[model samples]
Target chain A: MPHRITSARKLMQGNEACVHGALYAGCRFFGGYPITPSTEIAEGMARLLPKCGGHFIQMEDEIASMASIIGASLTGTKSMTATSGPGFSLMQENIGYAYITEVPVVVVNVQRGGPSTGLPTKIAQADTMQARYGTHGDYQAITVAPASVRECFEQTVKAFNFAERFRTPVTMLTDEVLGHMREMITIPESGELEVVDREKPDVPHEWYHHFEITPTLVSPMASMGDGYRYHVTGLVHDQDGFPTANPNEIKAKMDKLRNKIVRFADEVTQLDVEMVDDAGIVVFAYGTTARAARQAVHMAREKRIRAGLIRPITIWPFPDDQLRELLAHVRRVLVVELNQGQLIHEIERVAPKTCKVAGLTRYDGEVLNPVEIFKRILEVK
Target chain B: MMADPIQSSNVTYDYLRVKKRFPNVWCAGCGIGTVMGSIIRAIDKMGYSKDEVALVSGIGCSSRLPVYCDFNTLHTTHGRAIAFATGVKLAKPSLKVIVVTGDGDGLAIGGNHFIHACRRNIDITTVLINNQIYGMTGGQCSPTTPHDSFAATAPYGNMEKGFDPTTLAKAAGASYVARGTVYHVQQLDKLIYGGLNKKGFAMVEAFSNCHTYYGRLNKEGDAVAMLKLMKEHAMPVKAAKVLPPEKLEGKFLTGVLWDVEMPEYCELYQNLIDSFQEKDKE
Candidate 1:
């Protein structure tokens, strides 16, 4: 396919691409701390954000970084922060605050090996589960995984759009390999990509409820100085955004926090499926591991074996419906990930009952190769 | 419009979120309410429109003060109010930002943020309500909890020395730092008002009474007695300067402890942006 490029094409690191993507998406404020594998994103943001008339602050820590972005977003600026695993762990508390208060912000986690500072500069997808359940709460998460440098740019833009549209924190999961690896990519020019801003309340300031529940479930947000003086709290709040403990109001608030994202799951789910229509065996993978999975699928097809690849761009609302429909006829599915086993559990949940789901795991801080995954595919028979 | 808080009760009512329930979450005679009134009176006296101000707070009894006030209020996670207010101020710079935090919330769990916020010298007014205990979570030892004072966590009595918040702020590069007691309500208002008018990071440490927790746990009597203790122990900074070391040993200093000029973070950031973008245009 001949692609139209309105801007200059250049060789860029994945992290550099992410910074450009964030700028293209109208992100005006960045608050982050320095961490390995992901530091480039913060570095690039610091170097470039000022030229764009935006602000970049290196916070005291990841917790403050998360808190700062939420605060910036309240003032109607598109804000984001970048960090790795240990820092992501520190950000969980404030991420939960963003979830409960329904503030729109983006968190970019360039995955490094971790249980606790496991491998600072190595590749690992162990945070896939952490991205969903890291915060102590019962709210659904919106996370996107990008496998390539080009996808890194595109996925980050999509991440911001989802955050603004859903009025929730969005996580972009890119690993060490993708974050540091340089690749040739065509940067999208201004006005080329669709940028979505948060919906502001149209009602009079007196009638404005910060968390007003409408048919869409998402509320129109007002910036701090916009004159709609409303209260936002992490406490279970009513539609007017005041803390409330009334049982009915509590349930309704929880339901709104959930269904706001859950009901729009299909719209949030992004998937790339190749040759899965008639394949008897398929590999499920995401992030950098999906590159090997794709290559392995091609190798199996060349050998006259029916094989396919399914990579989810959106990892958290985890493409359940798409996988169910795609895997109905598949007899066996192999999950390839850089972790011990993460997405396999979700695949096992959604795969057809007749299909055997298995995980080809690697956690020694090494990327999976096409041969190793192909060998696993042959063993699936 | 700058009416005295004691003389005018009707003026401060304009700042309350009157639609919300009355009889706030604080215990009776708790000094947090008095500190809240002081803040409200300070903002009222300054004549800032409620729409142009943002009140950010972390988790605690004092943090709940923002929810009751008519302004853009954000009650964030524990120990993160200053960090959030930093973003709010840096994002807008036009909005008057204030952070209401407690001893445990501001100086302990959030100590790093508190010090860093002071170091940045951003344009933010922080009202640190130091009751010397975690009042909301019951009587637990805080960063400002007195040495050998009883608390739920420090039942055998706290061994660590308490932090002098005004001194800490001064050392951390704050442009303005002041100490006041809830017992000195008018002075507290003046101190907070001084913080509001300052251009850079401002810290107003208001020594409040956690009578429900710190008072009862230490057998320091009820809220009234705690207020009396504050009144008795407080000394003006000017008076303490002339007094002997022994005469000021157990007494705390009231009024502005430090004041200086410093470049505000937001303005510095904007200048950097303008310089860079102007060069880019060239």
Candidate 2:
């Protein structure tokens, strides 16, 4: 049997690849405030974007940067902002605005230690839950975690595509290690990529309903001056982007936005499974910590633990159903993350109580090493 | 009898929907209304179609200016107006993007955006309504609050120095930088007009008076007295040459401080699209 070859060429860091991914995916505007670990993404965008004819703005603060990107996106340009923990916290209100308005934009959170600028340059994944619920509202968000620098490029492009396709903000949750780690990315020429743009209404501009969900529940966005007279607001809005106080209208809009992605879960959720078919123990992880877990699973196999690894590329929609199916036959499930037991709770909710579940948690501004995770896996077994 | 001054046919205040409603949000004797008037007059002078202008603002009393304007207006979150306006302008480069922000909204909270917007040199005109104190927040100290100025937050007087908005704008690479005061209404109108005519990021800082907060706190007298003092105090840059620093003491120089043409962010983007299309054709 012959193995298939991919033409994905390589030569970039995770941050640099993110810049390329954004440009390839048609992102024309970047508004960001410079913070450690994530600053490279902004710096890279500033240097490379001019050649491609995109605009890069380092805003006054993270709040403005986040707001500007949403504004830029409303104008029909793919826009994004990158920040660390404190900055990400400031972006919550505007993020909620994007969520409510159904504005398509990408926000890259390169996780650093936080609760308030905890460690400006150190790595942590504490924001995993924040990524899901940082903004004040009942809303669904698409968040992607890349385990490697190469995945940083690939996942960033996917994040932008997801944002456009779903007509919502997508977060690329990167951690400090991956953001700063230089890696070889085989750069594909512009023509070899699959870039998705938002679906525009087939009806004429006047006939267009800004938030009117069709069969797919995703509406086409019209730019401001395109003669499309429509309103956009932060409040719970009806199909025309006007504020609606009726509970039914509010529930309908919120439910549609939340359910669209979850109903189409198979299309949005992605994961990498290793040795799960015959293994008795399953180890779950995501983002950079997944790298350590992968190595730990291999170590567990060497010790005859028969451990498998599950890495969720897409963190939200939680991969609950898929994990439940995977966990039914396993004797034990062990979750590993840099945060102190954040994602493990989600895993426990999906996995049956009959199956023992445990977490290997760490939050000292350091990556959870494979050795520590291996020890924990053995201890759990 | 002297013929009525030729009101340039271009100058027509026909479409500003909110101009007729007086008693604006600005404090009594506040310079913001005068600065706003100057901007409206300048737009009228330039013959800019109101339909083509999009006014964006962040959270502040000054940010509320957009809500009053008839054209496409966006009243956005605090300190994020420029960011939102950037989006509006990039999305429609043909639309005139005007951001009306105050010292606190534009500088203190929105300061990062102010510098970066200038750095990008996006084709937009920004009127930074600098009233020194954060008047909307009940006279709290702001980034542009002059050193030793009194505010609720600065009970012992502000020890930190204030930013010279024009100098900062120029240093941050704004293509055009100008200074004016509400007292100098005609000069402000001219500066705004010049800023609107410029092709890249242009900023006109209007040294507005906040008679309610900054005034009462600083013992700057009542609104009428302050207006009289402004008239008596301010000296033009040209006049300052013959006059000593003491003669022109405490008076701000008003005029266009910097103006130059540079490749704007949007046009460069358009050129890229054009070139890409050309390459495809080849």
Candidate 3:
């Protein structure tokens, strides 16, 4: 029945577009439990996946959901899971396992207000750091933040692409506002966008290894039932995918793991930069707060306050080089986010030393409208 | 027979990666070796071309079984082996998915996933090694720790009654449920073989003893003494039914306690897809 909804101009919710984007990205398996603000993704996947010849499983808990998706990904299936704050916290341990094992998965975290379930339905971006560091162990993360409903579609597709490209879990970090926000979205037809699948081992079975290192560093994966008969462990391993205790081998593996994301920074980073070429005060925002920052920048320009907006599309692999390049001519940078001061610290560390960086954060479970951000823009100047 | 690649190699080397993985990270007299041997033998007997097999285990001593196995192995986080195996099974229904978990890992922290896997009745075999204590973390009282047993954590003797995992699995709707002891090696091998061949969720709760921890703490002597005690107290469920109710106290019931066929999870899911595609045809 859902396949009959072929209208292109329909007002799709952010979470709905995310599911559509996942399907467009060739995701065949979704293993997720319901959580507030993120439940719609699961519901959408549950309803629409089978219609598309895909799989949807409502797992027992967040940990299982995380584990399940990783398992599915190991079968050379493009897999994903969705969760909000509390469930995301429960999934942190296994999330680390996915990291160390270098599995390709896209985890959708619809942010809600929380230290611990602080506001189930309210919008907040307080989990920015949690998404980066929630999982224990030494591995880098790839987090993508989507502000507009269109980005919810495109960024999710990119999230899948990056997950497959890096052979690591990529997070589409959307908040309650973006998740629940309804707006018209244009989803490209099949083959309109590039879809990536994880590379498969082309060598003979005797010579094949699961994490075989080449110039790409992102090793080609082998499915479980394939004749490779490979091993995958959460423990550090050599190229053969077996656990190793040797310090040199462990260090080499860990170095390659970290360097894979770091070296691909140029190709992976995404940012929305507008009018920052000559602005005195540039506003940096992400997610819900970026919505207001765009409006505030437009309003500030009307008054000739020389303001612009730089919204980070890729939040985890922080846009250090992009921010430095964009904020070169700008004098003051105002970061507006739903959280009090999460992303501002990141901008402070990366933004050029010449710029005066400030944060106009709202953590009171309220949206930072254009007026609030406009006030911050004026105050920063 | 010698010309065959599988038969040409020894049992352990045929099913495992290389000899470098052994001597396993196990102590002398560890019953886990016996259980691991049985698991490998069962896989060898099935002769499914191990590439079609995926052995997944969560973090624990028992979970380490996958690390030594040559098959496509996934050593995941603690207590979520069944959940991971569920993904493996659903993704590729043709693959024989097996989860190796310990009592604490399966019933304590991962209890939610364990029961849900049973309820879903997914096609996977879960071999839960119940050592009655946390062996890897040095003998803490596990969920299956017997009442009044001395564990490292329960130095004064445990007050809680331990869980019968077979009952838990059966109650949770696992299609096949069985219990076997490390002492009864042949019976355990058969139970595991039956479990692997079962169409839906199958659980074999093997009562393995941790001589280093639970055994020494409870004065059960060494591994041999513990095995001897288990052999004496082990009663077949059929045999226990004939015994007086009072005499059955403290005796472990062994054998196939539960077996029933139901609609398998992934197979039914495929039916759902076919029906949806049928609607699409209209």
Indicate which candidate wins on lDDT: 1
Q: Where's the lowest-lDDT run of ten residues in candidate 3 chain A? A: A1-10
**lDDT for residue A221 in candidate 3, whole number 0-100:** 85
The better-scoring model by TM-score among 2 and 3 is 3
The docking category that best describes candidate 3 is: high
True contacts kept of each: 0.91, 0.42, 0.90
- What Cα-based lDDT does every candidate model obtain? 0.91, 0.82, 0.88
TM-score of candidate 1 on Cα atoms, chains taken together: 0.97
Candidates ranked by lDDT: 1, 3, 2
**Model 1 off-target regions past 4 Å?**
A1-7, B1-8
Q: lDDT tens digits, residues B156-254, model 2? A: 999999999889999999999998877788998999999999999999998777788888999988877677767876677677779876887678777
- Chain B alone, model 3: TM-score? 0.94
DockQ of the candidate models in sequence: 0.86, 0.29, 0.83
**RMSD of every prediction:** 3.0, 6.0, 2.2
Model 2 pairs whose backbones collide = A9-A186, A9-A187, A10-A185, A10-A186, A10-A187, A11-A185, A59-B112, A60-B112, A60-B113, A72-B87
